[model samples]
Target: MASNGLLRECVQQLKSSKHDYEKVLGGSVEVVWQSVSSAIERHLRLKKGVGVPGLGKFSFIRDFQPLTPVFLLNDRFISSYGVSWKRPPPSLVIPIAELNMSVLGSEAGLPKDQVAQTLDAVCAFVGGRLQKGSASGRIPVGNVGFFQCEGKNLQFVFDPSFVKSLVQSSNDAKPNVKPAADPIKPTVQPNSVANRTSIAMTDAIGSISQLSLSRLVNEEPDSSSDKSSDQKNDKRDHHRHHKHKHRHSKSTPHLPLSTQSDTQTSTSTQSQQILPRFLMLDPLRAPPRHLTSDSKYARVQDSAYERETEDVKNRVARSAHEVEEIARRTKAAQLRYLQTKAEKSVLEREMNAFLHGQMEFKRNAKQQEDARRSSAMEYDAVKILPRDPIVTAAQRREVKLKLRRRLNDQVALKDDLAKQKRAVDQAESAYFLSKLQLHAAHEQEERAERQRIEREALVAGWTQQLAVRAQHEQLHPTRKHR
Candidate 1:
């Protein structure tokens, strides 16, 4: 119960610190609690104790009583001594968060958020690894302990050598100082039981001897007459006997009935005074009895019954509250699920429309590319002729008809060359157009590839989310109606 209280306190501290932690660790309180609890479990399993700088240590102690030789002698003896082989409950020391955030931040050599992220990552890794290895029995972790899984729970068994080493180290650290001397009196062997008993006996004997000598000195002188002497002796003996018996009764008030009766009879019968002697004797006494009123017992019983009833009522109330909380959360989760489903559908529709537009654009680009190629082919098929020099005139003057024919020939050649130049320009324009179309197609392909990648990423993210939701539901299943 104390451990549970401490764990709850620890969880609360971690939850409060989440605001100052990284976004990666800014999950629900339950997630943080689970992560922390798992981390603590793993730490205890790996090392007997885990020390987190600025956050105190979480230590595990095994609770068991070793069996002695006497207990091992027989089953009856073992049972009589209450020796048990059943596993003892674990003892855990949960750390309290007392150090300031600044101290942790400084120790980590990073900002608070980054430190939180690092710690979270470490916890997740360790916890996940341990959980995965849980099926294997007694996996050794360093030299401290072996981690074992009992059904679903993890357990740690400390190594005897490690424990011994720790104990030895602690003992070596302590100062060795001689004990102080006794103040009253010095004895040869002060620590020995025999010496103490002998010293007590000697002191008691000396006191008795002193009392006897004092009594002898205080006695009145004996009478000269035989009758008077006898009477004085008898009176003195009687006085001494009564005094001794009174002192004995006072010293042992709770003597048994039989012992008391025997002592009384013996005192009445004895006429001679017995000298006081020191004798070690165990007193025969009964244990004290207690008497309680019936009404008081009845009241106590009533109070216990009332307490039990109240506890039951509180448990029922808590159970009802938990059920209500679970139901509310489930409903909220369902609503969110519906909202996400709607969003996913809308995204899918948008993606499909975008892909259709891209396909249409690619088709137009292909058509333009084809048209440019056709024009280029046509230009390649055309032939261009070199321009001819104008015919030189003869030395003598020529006839008018002959000069007209030569001018006409020159004009025709010029016309043919101009047409050829026009054709060449058209071919060059077509070449440029084809190159532009090719570039546009390459851009469209790149854009399509990027969109495909984006779509895949979106789908993968949705799949991961769904998987997580399913796993969560599996872990904390709700009651199903028939």
Candidate 2:
């Protein structure tokens, strides 16, 4: 988050410029702003100033309490000359600001403190967030219009060019659109999915409202948590199988055992139908005779047109009937497929359980035969269990040597543990420092980027000022017309 003092500067300049030229008169006396009545007389007498062959005229107009200069910068007059002043409608400002906030990287690039500061700066006197979002700055001067960015960038738009371009669409007539403030930065990265989607409760789902945003953020399942449950299910499945086998093995003379259940399906848990909400509108009462001025033309056209309409409607009905029949057939086929699948699953489950029983039968028989052979061998030979490797080595070692080695290994193990602990502590410290450094560097980069943009803006502003002054000189009386 970075910003500048230009918005305030623009307002101050506007006020000063207006204050300097409220009234212009012949030399030798203080020229006062005319009284309300006198000003009306002067204004009524003043025609649009004539233009030179290559340069445009300059005029003065008032907005709020300030009288400001309007230049015909584009030859006829600067785009500013044609403004018919009115308080901008609420509809326009609100939507414009919303669009800008969305475009300016989801307000995340700006720190909370800085965002509040900017909001306060632009919204100080009037206009509020809407104008702040739309205007770049609240103060609009006459012809020499300026826009401000958070120390990020600033721009002066020839309001006229914008209007002309907008007009060249539709009827090819651009509306009188106001100039705008400029970019947050030169390389203002659009808010990424990570950032944009990060706007938890009120992110823009674009056309979707805040309610939808709430649903999207809140509706997502915790995927990591889901993975944990899957692991638990695997363990549970083993446990379940163990119990099933143990209980079956103990039973033979009692009631017969039934097979386990079929595998559950996804559709079993979630049932939803995607049906459209169909609506039909009823016809309203016909209008009075005066609403139909051309009775004869209507009468002649109505018959043919009505027949054509009816024919089209009938054709549509037939097509709809065909579609309905196809849909009905498809639904029946789907139902049959589902039923056949259910039957197949049941059969598979039973078959698997039967196989398991057969495997247990063979396994039990083999174990009994092995147990009998082991018992017969035990009568002839004494059984000695195999010793662990460490115990066997200890049997051959001197007690003194074994004790020393044991003590040494204990010391080594402690040292190893200590080393591991230190390594872990260092890792933790490094991780924390790296996180802090990364965050600090990110903020620094953000600041530098913003500053770079501001510098670019200042440069552009200087260029525009030179161009405007050149244009003004072209209209100078002492200089020959270009």
Q: CA lDDT of each candidate?
A: 0.48, 0.40
Candidate number with greatest lDDT: 1
Tens-digit per-residue lDDT, 1-482, candidate 1: 01223223334555556465533343333333333444444544443444543222445343222210000012232222222222232232333232233444554444555555545443343344333443323333345544443333344455677566655554565578467645433323455554455445454444433332222222233244446547658978888646555545666566544446546644532432222222111123211223122345335534554554455456545544554565568668966876786677567546755765687699899999888877854777577999986665652346666888899999999999999999999999999999999999999999999999999999999999999988877877763221
Question: Compared with the true structure, what per-residue lDDT tens digits does model 2 show for residues 347-457?
Answer: 754675576568769989999988888785465556679986665655667777989999999999999999999999999999999999999999999999999999999
Let me know the TM-score candidate 2 reaches against the reference structure. 0.18
- The residue pairs in collision within model 2 are 3-150, 3-151, 4-151, 72-77, 72-78, 73-78, 166-174, 167-172, 167-173, 167-174
Instruction: Evaluate model 2: give its lDDT.
Output: 0.40
Q: What would the TM-scores of all predictions be?
A: 0.20, 0.18
Question: Over all chains combined, what TM-score does candidate 1 have?
Answer: 0.20
Clashes of each: 0, 10
Error of 2 at 460 (Å): 99
